[model samples]
Target: MPIRMHDTLRRKKVDFSTIEAGKVSMYVCGVTVYDRCHLGHARCYLSFDLIHRWLEQSGFDVHYVQNFTDIDDKIIHRANELDGDWKKLVDENIETYYEDMDALNILRADDYPRCTDYVDDMIRITADLIEKGNAYVADDGVYFSIESAPEKYGMLTGQILENVRSGAGGRVDDTGKSKRDHKDFALWKAAKPGEPTWDSPWGAGRPGWHIECTAMSMDYFGAQFDIHGGGHDLRFPHHEAEIFQGECHTGCSPVVHHWLHNGFVNLDGEKMSKSLGNFWTINEILKKVDAMVLRFALINAHYRSPIDMNDALLNDAERNYNRVLECYVTSLKGCLAENNVPLPVADFASTNPLSKSLALLEKMGEGFAKAMDDDFNSREAVAKVLGAVREIMKMHNSDMDAVDSNAFSHYAIDWLEETAGAVLGVLPTREMALAEPEEDPRKLEIADEVDALLLARTQARSDKDWAKADEIRDALHQMGVVVTDTAEGPTWDLA
Candidate 1:
């Protein structure tokens, strides 16, 4: 099946095609470099990662670009709030961003153009807009006249120019700023006392938030590209501004063919926000679950659907992740067994366990592709993977070593690596996925406490106080200890 995806601009699913045949040019808006990346960032980036993986697996040459806003008001404000150098803070946070993102296995973009590096390009673009009568120099800075190209105003948000929100990439305040029209946004901002500044024709100031993206994206992908994506929050002013600047400057109506936006990360039915204290950084969540488990949790839902992140979602992810990992390990074990017999059934269509299992595996493989083809439906694709695992689970270890089990084992290995490992990116090596988890030193010190609880439970059972015994057992469970009565006394271990 050909790939079809939900285009945010058209507001419907359509067949995905590239400007150049067999090639894709994609740009995903990147972080502001003011802080660590949180779960919301993970969902957005991983959503693109899933799309990138599938495109390559389906045989398209994908050239991906994700930029960094190393110079922004937030970065400067954060630096001043912490009494640190803005450049140093931006550098450290960009380093941390890569560390956090790489931990989740997001593929690096082909180009990472920093906004600061493209100031000259932005200055030229802003100057050309002014020369062409689309922009004007104001006391504050150069502002793009919305009235010059009002037709591009409501392309993404569907609101007309008069009714559009004054949300221009988080630039809300109009304090002491001069503009010809109230709706006009900045092309360059006049330098402030302590903020970073660069030389431009208008003044010694930096480019505006919207113009940086226009300069950088056009520099890489010409005037138009295949896809432009970011978090759902960026669709309104940021992307709309990009379109306004790009099309007005290049005399092109549509600058990008597809505009893709991932849904927000919610917490307890509310949008996750730092103000609400519902935010969780990617590093913080990594301590609780395996990286692959986190990947499974985030991408388990469709890319365009809201993911209400909570413990329930994570627990389900860990359970399903273990199933896939265990099946992979079992397949590896079967292939490595020394005394395995390689049956020479060249046609291999006889009615046996191996033949039936192979047929089912082939069917599941097709199902996985079909689901992935339909807008990267990872939820259904994962079900197809678990479906294949079920088929393998029904076969015993010895049966996997049966007549033509080698073919089944090899087939399982290849199927998982291609579909799950390469496309979904939820599959990793068994050793890496099941590596020895960090042991808590505090857990080692709980042995004496566990012994006391077990002794009390034994005494309660001897006294026919069944409720007391059950209560004691529950207490142990609260401490993450599991107990089972053996022919000897009860044996205990951490759950």
Candidate 2:
């Protein structure tokens, strides 16, 4: 099936038809360089990373852009607390964010524009809004005129005027600006003493959080783009505000074609928040599980479903990840031992059981595509990959004597490695997956005893004591040595 994703704007499914043919422009909200990225950040970024990979593999040339709000309030606070230069602090955290993301195998976006770098663009937009009479300067800051775009002010958030009006009375400071309503928000924050600021037409000030994305995304992807994605929590004030302000300035009906939001991260059924003290940093969790394992765990759930960050769930994720790795390793071992085997021809003109397996793989790909297209459902897509693993495992256990080695050849191995490597990004080498000098004391001791048992068993086979031979095979299996009969006699390996 061709890719069709869920459009959050219309709240229905839609295909990825680009405004321009054969190319896609995507913008995702990037991290604010204030602290180390945590599990919540991991879940959001990885979800989008998978979406980007799928789009590329499905034949779309994607130009992905993300922004870094380096000059935000959090960065300023942290810098002052540490007695460090503010820009230096942003630079350090940006570097650290890249490091953690690289370890997780997320591809670099086409552009990572920083808010500090786009000050001129912001100033120009602010000037345009002012010229259009949609904004005014206040003693403390410049605020966008909500009354200017009254027709579509609360369209994105689905709130009525009374609710917006009621909510605003609590937050609005009526003493400052000559505002018609409390729903109006900041466009440019006035420069305070010792905060990062640039000289603008109104005064020295910085762009608001919502204005940064609006300016940066339009600067990169034009007035509108194919898709806009971020965490679900951002939908309310962040994204809704972005759309309202963006449309007001550009006089456009909608700022984006499709909006995608991945589900939230949870800890023991509660939202993972800094105040809850249940939140864990991505680097800190990396110390516990391999980065790939953590990625797998996050992908194990549908991107639209809430994920719980805990030890038990992660343990299961690790086991599932090992199973996928084991499939790759087992195939590698067979391919190495049977080097004379002919390569597979990727055609299926004749009807056969192998064709059924191939058909299953094709169906799996379709299922994954559908799920991913529907709001980037990575968990469901990964489950489809696991389903392919099941079929490959079945084929691996089938007898080779009944089939020609030249026919099946490396078909199963190639299929598993190619799809898994490209999609899930798990490809383990033989040395890393299986072969190594036994460092676990228990494995070494067991291997020694198994070798002694094998010697007696070999003698028994020579003496025609079939019962004794079978007994030793079972015994070795109980000790974790997987035994199999070969033309060269019985071969065994530590499980």
Highest lDDT: which candidate?
A: 1
Instruction: Write the residue-wise lDDT of candidate 1 on 1-495 in tens digits.
Output: 789999988999999989999999999999999999999999999999999999988999999999999987788889999976998898888899999888888888888899999998999899889988999998878999989988777788897877755534454444226777667878898888888899888778878889988999999999889999899999877998898899989988789999999998899788899899989999998998888889999989999999998889999999998898888877766564443455334233757666667677788999999999999999999999999888776763544445456556666778788877888887776676446667677777998898998999999988999999999999999999999999798988788
Off by over 4 Å in 2: 165-180, 336-356, 401-409, 428-495
Task: Please give the RMSD to the true structure for each candidate, in Å.
Answer: 4.0, 5.5
Off by over 4 Å in 1: 165-176, 337-350, 397-403, 433-479, 483-493
Per-model TM values vs. the true structure: 0.88, 0.83
Q: Give Cα distance to truth, residue 393, candidate 1, Å.
A: 1.3
Model 1 CA RMSD to the hidden true structure, in angstroms: 4.0
Judging by TM-score against the true structure, name the best candidate. 1
lDDT of 1 at 65: 93
Q: What is the Å distance of residue 158 in model 2 from its true position?
A: 1.0
How big is the positional error of residue 354 in model 2, measured in Å on the Cα after superposition?
4.2
